[model samples]
Target: MTETARDIVMGRIRAALAAAPPERVEVPRDYDRQPLQGPADVARFAETVADYQARVLRIGADEIAGTIAALLPVGATVAVPGDIPPDWVAGLATVPDDPPLSNAALDATTAVVTGCAVGIAATGTIVLDGGAAQGRRALTLIPDHHICVVFAGQIVDTVPQGFAALNPLRPLTFVSGPSATSDIELERVEGVHGPRTLDVLIVEP
Candidate 1:
């Protein structure tokens, strides 16, 4: 309470602060160099993504509908966003994006396919912004199978690059492969939350 006591306290506080451990920091460069091999980079991205229980597939644009059908069983309802191209749902029971189907209903569906804003090549992250094509967050959460369509042009080289390309104000879901977690013994468990299976269709023009 006294001035001398206050000064001593302040000095002690300063000394404690000075003695504290330094914070670990990561220096983010403007441009992080990607792997020299282009094919290898893509393959590595897919491999790492699959490690999270995500099914990654590279296919031509015209083959999308068929691929979707293959991933989902017959008579299975598929949730398609309002802005999803018609061609994207050629051979499935297309569920409309209105009234926002219940989670229970979504669980009954075979798959939920939506468009992605960006796919990062460096970390194999798929980002959704709740855009017209991506639809609400529930669509992705409730469904067991999530087929995200990522245009080749939308793929970026790195995480920083992807962030710079997107608007932070938007509702964004950054998906780095499928959902998984580890237990006490570091035992891995997949699909406890979010989609258990994430199928990414990289649409190459």
Candidate 2:
């Protein structure tokens, strides 16, 4: 039988390992398991999210509904996940995902309102696990604009901390900023894979 290049390389690797058995070294993996305490973490998260060019509105819990109404254009049809707070969408034209809107219907809406599962301060990322407030993945992806409500209590300081708080088995969507990418000439283009505009409402802890 003829030996190939891969075989030759493997044989050499085996010979080297046999000649000098490698030592078993224990890798220290003290992952980010520290408890989350205080509101500073939330402030950091808001600052980082703003650097991505997304609008970050830090408001009082009572101001959420009115703030959202003021930010959106009048007469715009807003899409909402089934669990969105009724008071938040009060007096606004809203379509819920009770029967699950078709892709065309989602595309036609002015914006989608959702609440994220987690917010990462380190990367300015928002994670969705299709929670009742988040709806299915399609609801946010098909819409042109996303108005995500993230509570200060949901913000974590690091990715590891964020993962620690999430279920590993759930379907998760990580959004760093409004869907955008540059062309070959480096011209910025938005709404490539998801909403072109992301408006984050960061309520006080």
Candidate 3:
């Protein structure tokens, strides 16, 4: 019968593959795996995080709830994961995400509070693995403001170190700073894809 356009394209693709040689390739991975020494450098990390235009506060464990509350506006509605420590957000107007909140509802919320899976001190990146305290990805993305509680113990020196502490199977979100992008003319805009304001509370023992 008739040779259709789809058939012609498939025939050409098959002919091209048959004429190509097959080979196996091996990738080189002899680079330095451990670049940094010891645990995360809190002072360096704070400085790097601040350079990104995000606020960083170092406080004792007892002051966590107060600091978080102070960072948020009065009467603000905060989206929180059910697994987060209750004392961390004590007396705050919080909506739990156990059943998962709708996008519209999350949009209406003023902020979101979460605990990160790991923090990369060298690059000032926060990694979230959709863990119990981190909740789903939508909860952190939809809010205008985000207050993340990061413990010193969870901080790592570099990206490689952070990766070593995380599981590849889980969903990962790495945040370096508040969502921002520059246009062709070099103008910068914030909160385009994520929170405009990121307040990182670095808790020490």
Number of clashes found in candidate 2 = 0
TM-score of 3: 0.84
Q: Across residues 21-123, which tens digit of lDDT does each residue of candidate 2 receive? A: 9999999998877867755377778888899889999998888888888878989999999889898788889999888999999999999999999999989
- After superposing candidate 2, which stretches have Cα over 4 Å from the reference? 1-28
TM-score of 1: 0.80
- Colliding pairs, model 2: none
lDDT of 3 at 119: 87
lDDT, residue 26, candidate 3: 83
Give the per-residue lDDT digits (tens) of candidate 1, residues 1-205: 9999999999999999899967999997757444333422455566666766688898998999898889887688898787788888886789977768877888877788999888777777888999858999888887878999887777767776678778999999989877778899999787778888899887775
Q: After superposition, how far is residue 149 of candidate 3 from its true place, in Å?
A: 0.6
Least accurate 10 contiguous residues by lDDT in model 2: 35-44
How much is the lDDT of residue 194 in candidate 2?
Answer: 93
TM-score of each: 0.80, 0.86, 0.84
Pairwise TM-score winner, candidates 2 and 3: 2
User: Candidate 3 — which pairs collide?
Assistant: none
**What lDDT does candidate 1 reach at residue 154?**
79
